[model samples]
Target: MDRKLNRELVKATALRSGYSFTKLAQEVSVSTESVSKWMSGETNPRPGKAIKLGKVLGLSYEQMFGVRDRTLEPQVAFRLVRNQDPSEEHHERAREMGRMYEDLVPFLPFNQFEAPPRLKSPTADYEYLDELCGSLRREMGLEADVPVSLPSIFNHLSDKLQAVVIPVFWGHRKNKAELAAHIYSRKTKTTWIPFNLDTKLWDARFWAAHELAHVYTFDVLDDEAGEIFSDAFAGTLVFPVPIARAAYEELAKVRLKTQKFNLIVEFAKRMHVSPICVAKQVDRYAVAKKQPPVNAEYDGIYAAISRMSKREKTVAEEFFGGEEPSVGQLLEAAANIFKSPFFDTLSKYLKTNGGSPSFIQGLLDCSLVDAKALNSELA
Candidate 1:
């Protein structure tokens, strides 16, 4: 279905929230003309801005579009690609999955975990975040210059923060939203994060790090600054400033663009992260050090990383084969590889409460047939 902004709903909600068009635009960092256009249905804001606008007007994305999912608890944080927003069907499916997780949390062994300390007075300052990440690296017993082990990172989230990190096969499509649903269930007082496992290993590592940052700083983050902090935190956590400085020193010696590209690719390969992560961290290091930023074509660097990632198998592919995996196999991958107890706990709950396979289908984004197999396996 062709979806457009619900102009009447936007206008009504904004008015109820005590916002004039100019005030609404100012609140969301858009112009009065743009707000008028959105209200007139002449244009629609990008997904990020639309969500921002909804937040300012006290509406959800679905509410602004006249199709609210009342079952979905308010989201603490979520990340989407710049150009692609989840379609309504995809959005609702994700929300339903999140609700299922929430329903099972009461039966899960959630109390064994503790929440991480929140950042006080969060800022997007490079040096401040760099230092914060440095402290976190040391606290986590990670060597500053070494590549962070992916399993170690996953275990940290599970053991330290009490977060349920569910890895689902979201498909290998361009412009797909990475973190579809990251909700903080008030009833359970737990955070449920489901990220795409379809991304390559390196990219998946970065995304996992990104979720870690979000869990760390959720209490202090807004939509915009939260993303900035999460990006910086993820980059610095995986490729810290010490490593960035070393890479920068090598990059400074190179004059050719190809040389700079090669140096970045090499650094990324060494760190086992995306070249984009490497490049951004290098830029942050340069800014903090008060030095001229290295010159590199970011698009070329990103394209190269994409090509390299294509060769590396995604988390799903690594665990299950290329064909569709049975629910039992998927759960095994989640439990073993992700180090997540979500399915194990849910299986216990299902045994007592007697739930349906459709819930499993929604949670794993798998077919009903696969979900039925999970019920049978549980039986």
Candidate 2:
């Protein structure tokens, strides 16, 4: 049987519900065009889907088709490659993950997540970035001039920021949107950062710092300025001013181009960041100190670093003991190694709320067979 919705009531309720057209359609397992048609009175939903829609909207059928009421957009900070926008599919998947975070918060073992205080009138200027990074490093009990241990940083920030760190094996092959995602659920007031564990661990560290910048200064909607802030913040946080100044001083004393390149490469190796990150930071430091910038071109440095980075294992590979791991092993690694409560939370949600293995597959973005195996283990 089909149930006809009052078009005006549906539109009003959907708007008041604060769900985007895509998300609303997702929650109801329908196409956005179908949602559009239903809201426009061009179509009606089947009885089962209609009931599901009402439940997802937290309203009884009488209230959904009869009455209307109530609001928050998720703040999405995608760490995309330069000049690239994630595909709509990627955005939809990220939003679904955000929805899961919203559903899982009540079962969290700690207090409600609180965002770190936003910077007042934050600027992306070099001086401001340097000072902010220095202060943050001190707060994290890290030495300003030494390379940071990513494991320490991860553990510290996970507890300090009170954010969920979800490590995902998006794919073994890298893509533009493969590093990290920062999604803030306004409804839950929680920040959910999902790290793509397919990239090199060095790249992951830098990207993690970038997301940390987003978490700390997430005052308003993300914009170009916010991205600028995050990029600068990540570089400075990983390679502080003191370290950059020292590297600059060392490079200044070197006259040969190869010597300078070697110095930069060594700095990158020591810092566990890309050569471009080290090169750019040193140039920025030189400019800030009114010194001549390093006289090296970066055309070849990129390729050289790319070849060098292939030797390192990604976060997931390391967690799984450097071989293709089973789905169950991946879930265990996510829990025991990454210390992520996401799987446990999902397990509890399934047991209490009565869900299927398909829910696990969707939330973890895994195969149905793997999800079933994982479900039995979680059960």
Clashing pairs in 2: 16-70
* Candidate-wise lDDT, in order: 0.73, 0.73
Q: Which 10-residue window in model 1 sums to the lowest lDDT? A: 68-77
Candidate 2 per-residue lDDT, tens place, 1-379, comes to 1235876666677789897778999999889998887887786664445667777777666565553221364667676644377664466456656766687788766565444566777777899888888887888788887776665556655667766777776664345355788888877778878888786766776888887878777755356788888888899989888888888999889877678888988888888877778888988888778998675445576677678777877777666666778767777766666566777877787788876776776566655776788788775
Q: Which ranges in model 1 have alpha carbons more than 4 Å from their true place?
A: 1-72, 81-83, 86-91, 112-116, 172-180, 297-299, 320-328
Cα lDDT for residue 271, candidate 2: 86
TM per candidate comes to 0.75, 0.75
Error of 1 at 72 (Å): 8.7
TM-score, prediction 2: 0.75
Q: Write one digit per residue (lDDT tens) for candidate 1, span 30-103.
A: 88999998888887765556778877877787776666434435355556654355564455445545556776
